[model samples]
Target: MFRRICLQLHWLIGISAGLVLAIMGLSGGMYSFSSELIQLIDPQITRVSPSNAAALSPAILLEKISQHSPYVSSLSLSDDPEQAARVGFMTPQADSGAKKFEQQYLNPYTAELLGKPASEDFFRVVLNLHRKLALDQGGKALTGAATLALLLLIISGMYLRWPTTKSLNWRSWLYLDWRLSGRDFLSRLHVVLATIAMLAYLVFALTSLSWSYEWYRKGLNALLGNDSATISKTANASRAASNQSPSKALDLAAVWTSFRTEVPHYQKLILLLPSGSASTVQILYLDKQAAHPYANNRMVFDAASGVLQTHERYADKSPSAKLMASLYALHSGSFFGSAGMLIMMLVALLMPVLAVTGWTMYLSRRR
Candidate 1:
């Protein structure tokens, strides 16, 4: 009776939440290779000719960018001599539908403006769909519910497919019986493919919920011993300090010099400038031999004096902190490497297959 109830719940959730899961999965799969895809579209903007001369200082690059946009929210510099620096800006929007954030590349050595990237807007839409179904708060809630339902579905489906002692065999569990017809074949194919992809789906459902629901995020944070309140307080303090101060200008040259002197080696360096009235500047960079793409060391500096206030090395972070930091890498499978990323992407793309097959079987049963 319990098994029957579980099977019924599994199909019910599969029919209802499965569509949303498929949408999420397909969007995620497309976005997995976003960087590679963008580079394929236009390589010149991001890539630069290697120059013998040292790259220009952050202040000079900012001065050059001032000709295009007066305010820069952030700057990304690459140690690879052949990569261009990226500058982010908060441009004024003409209307409600217009985009407010913008980014453009610069020749770090010559300070030449490299126009905005291609297909960024399209990718932005895809990202929005994955996160919130492009409907903002309401979509977030719906997606969160669906993600939670997906977790339950995975559990119930696994339970329903558990083999009895007599039927326990590699062929029964792993291989599809193509000889069977109608519903029997469908059942065999569905269970077999699902079993193959079960681990990947489990990872997706578990890691993705961290973004979809606030309660889930907080719970994960607590579980990982991340001090959310402390982080919030520090951010609030920075904003309050900015409001109390009269000047908003940052000494980019001094901060860059200080950073270079302290940590001279890095593959890529990103300086996050203060927006609005914020008085602190946060800089993040990856080591020459970073553990993963997301393993970034962080530093906070006073915008005016360029005085180093705080620094956090990725290596020095607590286990929980490191795990929390690595959530994105784990979710996208980049933590493992290029092969893992491709595998995860393929698995994501196959989500629609599962949904369609499940729906077909459900409808046929109903008839």
Candidate 2:
């Protein structure tokens, strides 16, 4: 009776959310390779010929950027010598739709503006399609619903696909028998691939819950015995909020130096200028092997006092924080680096293929 119920719910949810899952999966798969491909699209602008010379210091780079642009909002460093330094500039209007701040690459050695990279436009479209479905708030809600449905599908699908016996042939369950034809072939192949890809799908689905539901996020936090780890601003953010606003024009150079002393070995550093209520100079730093490269770790400091306000590190993260950080890694397959990315990309593509075959099998069964 329980198996019958699980099967019915699984089929119902899969049919309802299959199209959305496929669209999201395919787009996500493509985006797994976006950054590298984006740079390659316009190498002349995005990539500088590897310089034998050391790149400019953070202060020098920011100063050069400030002179050219209205303000230096932040900057991102690339380990690759060929990669141009990404600098942020404030626009007249807040970014209601696109890139957080208008970003352009600067030739790190020369401080020359490289304009926009080619992948900016392409990623914008793909990201919009992935996140908001090329629409607005309504689209976000729809996608969120689809994500919730996917979570349900994972839970129910696992129950329905449970092996009848522990001794069931592992080969038959794991691989397709090409000798079979028609409905039998589709059913067997679908089960095998679905079973093989379930773990990847499970990771994607679990991570996606945070974005799709606030309740789920809060619940996850509660369940994990920690505060929300999705976005931590302070060093002891797991304990209390300590984002101090030091009202004054920040000395970018000093902030950069302090960071150099604090975190000598870092992956990428982004320095955000104080604004509005946030009078602290927040520097976001990621370790070379941080699970989520960009968003996981941060160090906030008082701009006026030059006193450290908060230092959020991945290693210092609580269980909830670790799980939250793992979201990006799982999503992009960056957890395992190149191999993980390839596996995730392939899994993403397989989502739609499975959806189609599963749908066909259901139809055939009904017939």
Which candidate ranks first by TM-score, i.e. highest? 1
Lowest summed lDDT window (length 10), candidate 1: 238-247
Candidate 1 segments whose C-alpha is farther than 4 A from its true place = 94-99, 166-168, 233-248, 275-277
Clashes of each: 0, 2
TM-score of 1: 0.91
Candidate 1 local lDDT, 1-367, one digit each (tens): 9998998999999999989888988998999999778867877887888788888898888777877776566788887788788887765567774435567888999989888776766888888888888999998888888888878987998888888667678886788766899987887778887888888988888888888766777788788788977755754654443223123577888888888888889988777777556777778899999988989888998888889989989999899888877889989999998998999999888788889889989998999
lDDT string for model 2 (116-152, tens) is: 9767788878888888788888878888888888778
TM-score of each: 0.91, 0.87
Q: Which pairs, if any, clash in model 1?
A: none
